[model samples]
Target chain A: MQKWADNRAWFLILPVFLVVAFSAIIPLMTVVNYSVQDILGPGMSVFVGSEWYKEVLHNPRLHDALFRQLTFSFCVLAIEIPLGVGVALTLPRKKGVWASTCLVLLALPLLIPWNVVGTIWVMFSRPDIGLAGVTLNEIFHFPYNYTADPLHSWLTVLVMDVWHWTPLIVLLGYAGLQAIPEAYYQAAKIDGASRFAVFRYIQLPKMRGVLLIALLLRFMDSFMIYTEPFVLTGGGPGNSTTFLSQFLTRLAVGQFDVGPAAAFSLIYFLIVLLFCFVFYTTIVNLGKGEAQ
Target chain B: MRMKKRTVALLCYLIFLLLPIYWLVNMSFKTTDEILSVFNLLPENFTWANYAMIFTDPSWYTGYINSMKYVALNTIISLTVALPAAYGFSRYNFLGDKHMFFWLLTNKMAPPAVFLLPFFNFYQTVGLFDTSIAVALAHCLFNVPLAVWILEGFMSGVPKEIDETAFIDGYSFPRFFTTIFIPLIRAGIGVTAFFCFMFSWVELLLARTLTAVNAKPIAATMTRTVSASGMDWGGLAAAGVLTMIPGAIVIWFVRNYMAKGFALGRV
Candidate 1:
């Protein structure tokens, strides 16, 4: 919205700026300070130039974790997007008791605290006590132990994430669907347009805005996922479940490799920034190819 | 048959969602011995001791009180600050606005783990450590940006003419904002507040780090209970179920706003 030149708008923004700066900027400065200095005694330390960055870059564990992280994020997006859209499409349009019930039920996973989600999954996948594991192993004879099996652990985490997040996409897509006036559907029906045609031309196009947002949000979140998997696997099964943020936590907090962790954190932040730039551009530049 | 297919898909998904939660609930009611030893789908030997224990212990119940305090504090603080900032972005063409917006969002992008250590040292040095306000302010880092983002989206959809008309009618800026502007975007406020609450409530790392006893969250409390000689499974399970209740209640109250929020108030 263009308006008269009013630098005074910054006054309105001052409170937010102050609060965020207090919480974000100061801690960021500490991280930058820690990245350069090597602590030895109470105050004695050597100034390490880019030595920590060099060392962190060459670390094989980081390479492996980065690869796994990329794969996991890709898998999350690939699975969640289509599944969320499908569910959203299938959802009833009328705002009635049934729709609200579904909305509440669907939101249950998203509302639960992250650690509780981890706890639920950990308990539910326990072969000895969990109904899920026991049913899979004893009843269906499909053996699975997330603690012992690396692939199984990865798969379980993926399943848990999907269960937790797909509803969000559904909610967003359903909202988009709700925003579409009934006239368009009626027009489509009168024109003898097929269901797929109406979806492709009308619904999908209208939903694109919300879907793109949902996509970026899910990507950013899944890329930095930590708490649930940390609780579920503790980055175990030979570090198979250790994603980038978890790996960064291991370096920074677990081992107290502060210098290396700070360096790695900058690198990790850049990667997320790069992805955001690309996604932001794509969203802005959409519709050129499919304007028909 | 077509309608049934859609219903079935939703049913299957709902069942998948509820199963794990059901497992947690089932464990919460059973005795610790029953929970650890059996694979019962339903609690055959249900007990009330787990729920009773949480209510009886100051440490247990206080965890809930402490969490709610910080989360409520963060939500109120975030929305109060975010509303005007969102209006500024949505209504005006201020210099460097785009850059500042992205910079705000970067806080949301930064992993909480990266700030875990610095936050502790910073809060402690400032003498705010172990306080509910400490956790509340720390949560504002991410929540403020998000609150602003959602509110800005909603506010943009509102015509600028309304502001002009209100001004012409002799309402001061603040008066117009609260009386006329705010009620107009009440849905946006509801959505933004709901989100801020959801996020601050769920976050653990900073909350756990900032609080020693006075503000220790239920998530941290539950996590600690895992390291005993015999793990308090039932009690932990009760705490888990308890954590979900506030969120459930929130979703119920904001159910309609959520549809609009999901569509993103334009919150």
Candidate 2:
């Protein structure tokens, strides 16, 4: 290992640090300042200690939204992780036309804008005019009205998320899968290990690092889901789809209640940070354990 | 026998994945009346009116151009800053490096909803409100971290021996970076740029918050249509289809590098 003692490298990083700070940190400080006080208008705020935090914490709307957000995140991870791994396992390993087709198909959903995913589905499930809804009612008679029915709305949103994001998990899982050594599989075959045993012992452990990354990324994104459901349901049929992000948006933008909204956002930030720290530390510890 | 079952299951998964996209294309061809009346697999009365409306209207088509301008600008800005920062992190052991790396990532975790109000004020104060630059700069907050993280991983994979030899042969740092380092990580850069473009292109909240009328994204425009009229289903579908085209083109170009970049960043 070699060290470059000169301090010139710091200058190389200065521009990035400054850009990110200007774009991210300064505005965050402003949010913090707003969170602690009541803002009547621009620069017209008076100090109030923790009053907003108390209001945000005690609000039943936040409580319900938090529960819904957690359930949605957990459900997305549960579905996407396993489905992604399964898809990765089935994909052809060698470079060819088939491999290229699969890659293109998988990447398609990831590129579309979030609101468009919702719009597509909203049009897609229209009972009178949409394809899915009309097909279901006509063929299977399933009575799928996602906008009016809460359970149907939740299911539709979940399906839309899975459609849009599962490809990302598959892409990550495939990368991890491709990196496994041929020797490990060859040795497992020589030992007459069953496919299940081979996957459980060799492939699963090898994919642990990438899987953790996939999990954290999916969790964070799903937890902060806003545009998709906002477009799909408008948090309608009595707030069934109003997740935490929507709740925060309703406060900050819709109602313009700056104080509690800012406080609620900080708490939201802390929860996401708490989850990331836990997962990151766990992965780091696993790496250390493997090294030892 | 087991292999046959696995093949069937995989085929089923593929169909599940592609069905909705197939449906969108199917609906885009049908007239509003035909769509309302039929529950058939194929369009009964095919028409191009939806697409025609999208292409002909300046208001509709302009949103796509505006979105592309900001997304492209943001991608270029993010990559340029991130490449050097990624190199510095990968190649050098600078002071406060760990802290700086973590700081970069923290920006990504903060929800945009939290910063919406403050950002509006910040942009207004700085006289950047309603400009494409406001959205582009705000996008950098998340995209830069992503680009840096992915690029660093790719740079780390390239052998340090190459750098040592290049420097020993009297190649300047800039010369080595351009001639040797960049070519090796071209695939990595492509993948990073793709993700940046994808995220920035889809992002609506900050784009909506920062810009009101002049630089409104296509996503924001879709929301506005609902209020303007009683949900112009045909126009919205046309706009939705148009939105998918840029992403489709992007994926086609970078399809091969997708898995590798993802694996490296492990994101």
Candidate 3:
């Protein structure tokens, strides 16, 4: 649909602009202010331009955390996207008790508080008494302990994330599926298209929009994940599960290195923006290429 | 055979989803000793003491009220502002519209942990500290942008011809929006509200930081279980179970609408 050129439309947007600006800009400015200064007390502060930024940039821990954050986010997207779409495809489409029940069950994980999610998973994976831990050790005869083993810790965090967030993708994909007009399916049937062909042609293309939103949302959220991993592993066994947010939280809140923490925060925010920009443009350009 | 395969796959996935939840529920029904002592599929000594403690205690129950209060407030604010903003983005080629949209999302990208101190100071300075509205407004940092993004996708699906027709028929913009346009996208609104409620309800860091006592959220209150003594696994699990109730109720009310909501919006 072609949109009209209308500057008057700003009237409609002014409210949101004000609300977001009021909430976002002030705190942002504070972060920026702290990023450049050395604060000792309430009124004792010294200007330290670029000093904190340089220290944060060279920090070895930040580098490891950033690397881990990228890997975790990549793994999350790779696993959750396909798995969520597959689960959504199998969901009962017809509205009834079964469909409603599936929808409600799918939604349960998302509503739990982040800390509670971590706690639940923590108990659920305990080697002594937890189901997953006991089953793996006793029944499956696997040497798995998230607390002591870094690989297990990584796997545990990854699995925890998938369990927590995959529902979001399923919900989005299911909504996209629900939107496909009945006529499309009817037309496909009339043409005698194979199930795979119909899925490849009709369903996948229609789901592109929702899937894009899901991709961006999941990427950003996973990249910034903090509370769950913090609670689950305490960045565990030796900072193995620590992501970017937890790293920054340790610097800012734990160590109270205000300037460096603020500087690192800005860099962290930029990295996310850069990735989102790349994704938004790449997918959008791909769509344009297909259109052309 | 194919239909059976699909059913099996779905059931398997659902079982995977429910197992942890089942464990939480299982723990909730047992004593702390029972939870810690043995691996039980079902509670050995079924007790409602965890639930009983929460109901009898003011601290635990008030957390639920506080969470609900802010979540509801945030959802209402997000929708009210986002409705008009989304219409503008969908219908018009406004200046810097694309950039503005992207900029809005960057707020969502900001790590909440980093912003905690700033949010604490900002809210405290304006004297909105420890109020439900503080958390509600703080939540809008993310929820408003999300609401706009979702609503824009839905609004773009409504053909321009409908708006044109409404205008030609002498309906005022506000009246057309309220009477015709809103009903058409009620499902979208339902989905958006659900997202907003979910995000606000589950968030702990910002919610915990912004409010100390009067408006402390249930998620924040759950931290009380971790104090000096050993972990209160039963009580914590019980609170976790209770936190899910409000969101589940909201989802039930919006289930039908949500089934159809994502149909229009490109989002």
Q: Give me the displacement of residue B215 in model 3, in angstroms.
A: 1.4
Sorting all predicted structures by lDDT, with the top scorer first, yields 1, 3, 2
Residues A71-165 of candidate 2: C-alpha lDDT, one tens digit per residue: 99999999999999988778876778987888888888887888888888887887777778888888898888987899999989999999898
Q: How well is candidate 2 docked (DockQ)?
A: 0.67
User: Which ten residues in a row are the worst by lDDT in model 1 chain A?
Assistant: A283-292
lDDT of 3 at B130: 99
Per-residue lDDT of candidate 3, residues A1-292 (tens digit): 7899999999999999999998899898999999999999998999999999999999998899989988899999999999999999999878789998899889888888898898889889989778899999999999889999999999999999999999888988998888788999999999999999989999898788778878988998998898898778989889899898888888877888889989988888888889889877766576566657
Q: lDDT by residue for model 1 over A1-292, one digit each (tens)? A: 5565688999999999999999999999988887887877667878998888899889999999999999999999999999999999888888899999999888888888898898899888888888788889998998889999999999999999998899999999998899899999999999999979998999998888889888888988998899889888988899999999899988877898888898888788889888987786676467344443
Considering only N, C-alpha and C atoms within 3 Å, which residue pairs clash in candidate 3?
none
The C-alpha interface RMSD of every prediction is 1.4, 1.8, 1.9
- Overall local distance difference test of candidate 1: 0.88
Candidate 3 CAPRI classification by DockQ: medium
Candidate 2 off by > 4 Å: A1-7, A285-292
Candidate 3: tens digits of C-alpha lDDT, residues B1-267: 988999999999999998988988898999999877888799989999999999999999999999999999999999999999999999999889989888888888777877887888899999999999999999999999888987887787789999999999999999999999999988888889988998998898899888989999888887656544537889888998898788788888887766444332553
Question: What docking grade does candidate 1 earn?
Answer: medium
Error of 2 at A270 (Å): 1.0
Candidate number with the higher DockQ (1 or 2): 1
Q: Let me know the TM-score candidate 3 reaches against the reference structure.
A: 0.94
